[model samples]
Target: MSDTAATSSRRLPPANGATLGAMFVAGAVATMAFDLWGQILSPGLGWATLSPHGLARSLLGRFGLPNGDFAGYFVHFYLVGLLGYPLGWLLVFRPAWRAVIGAGGPWILPAALYGLALWVFAIGGITAIAGLPFFLDFTGITWVALIGHVLYGIVLVAVLRRFRLG
Candidate 1:
């Protein structure tokens, strides 16, 4: 068979259980790092709305949950960890998809793009559904969110690398 045929015919390996778990932990850490950054900057930046805790509070409140700051913490970490599962599983097990996305190189760019997409979905879709104004304004909160997302991407990439996950 030709090289291309052979490559195409090769099946991806199974997902590494340890890597998958590590990825989830990495995601949770990255998310918390982003939220911590937001909390640190929100006061001086005058963008308390950018706090993950605050956003989670609003989202939980919308669903009529006991939406305190503590509850928001759980919600934020849980969602972040949950989001990591698919990303980790697919990338770790599916080499073809990873190659297609150029994940073999430095992961910062793709991961940052992923973070930006998450921000768009959160502010544009989730916030809109919660009856809040969409992320139309490029204000401090916008900057905060953007920066936080980038930070999250950076941390996620770093942790994944440390864990030797694809």
Candidate 2:
């Protein structure tokens, strides 16, 4: 077969359809986290802002972070942001098998760590260690975001190397 044909007929990476579906689920969960924060947590803090952005800003203020008005959390902080990353890769780069397996493995673990770190830092001041429970109330969501972020990050690495996305 010619080089053009071989390139055109190349197969996909090993990451399964379910993994992709899970990625979408993770994204949805992230969005829900933002919603819950906006509706419930922000009001409790007297932030009174009903937007996701508002919730993040209020939380930053609550913790004394310099990142007021920051929007990167949607990508790094929330499960929805988690989803956005994978969804973007799945759609844009069309990940491959080697990339999927190698990247997907560690993706879930580290992403979760990062997500928790962000949360703890965000609320470390006002809540104290005792305040962790309230923030951690969304266990299911936390898992999703963390895992999703992991997958997203790994997939991003994979995509960058595999698909040549700049």
Candidate 3:
């Protein structure tokens, strides 16, 4: 059989466990790509860096929080990022038509958490543990960080339907 015919005949997920896993991985990778690309164009595009300190101060200032220091902002920003991380999941999982994870909340939460856990673990383990700051340091703030992740989620969904990934 020709390679083209064989490729076309390959069985795809009929809305089950494996498809869900694939979707989440695709989303996470999209996010990683966004980060890398954002940093690459940050200088020329005049985009703000995703620095923790800058993010903390911007958020605090918006809410009128008492944080007049950079160090304080950095710590608080990390906590804020963790808490709001699920928002990206909410955005991505809600629009999905298939229920590979089974039930509404079960699959959604796991998918979202899976993407988040993988990202944080990858960033910490690969970047920090492996001492790869020269590359990851491009995204040290939250404003641009949100842009990257939001774009990632959007691209993830778009790609799935566009290419019939499921």
Top candidate, metric TM-score: 1
**Ranking by lDDT, best first?**
1, 3, 2
How far residue 139's Cα lies from its native spot in candidate 1, in Å, is: 2.7
Report every candidate's CA lDDT.
Answer: 0.66, 0.44, 0.46
Ten contiguous residues with the weakest lDDT in model 1:
85-94
Q: How many backbone clashes does candidate 3 have?
A: 4
TM-score of 1: 0.72
Candidate 2: residue 13 lDDT (0-100): 30
- Per-residue lDDT tens digits for candidate 3, residues 1-166, read 9986563344333356555555555555564555554566554577765443443454455556665676444443333332233233433344332334443343334443434443564343434543345336655433355455455545554544444542
Candidate 2, 1-166: lDDT as tens digits: 9986564444333356665656655555544554465557655765543343543555555566654555535424453355544454444334343234443454334444444444444334223432344544544444443333344344344433333321
Best by lDDT: 1
Off by more than 4 A, model 1: 1-17, 41-49, 81-100
> Candidates 2 and 3: which is better by lDDT?
3
- Scanning candidate 2 in windows of ten residues, the lowest lDDT window is 122-131
Candidate 1 residue pairs in clash (backbone atoms < 3 Å): none
**Backbone clashes in model 2, listed as residue pairs:** 13-96, 13-97, 14-97, 30-79, 30-80, 107-150
> Model 1's lDDT to the true fold?
0.66
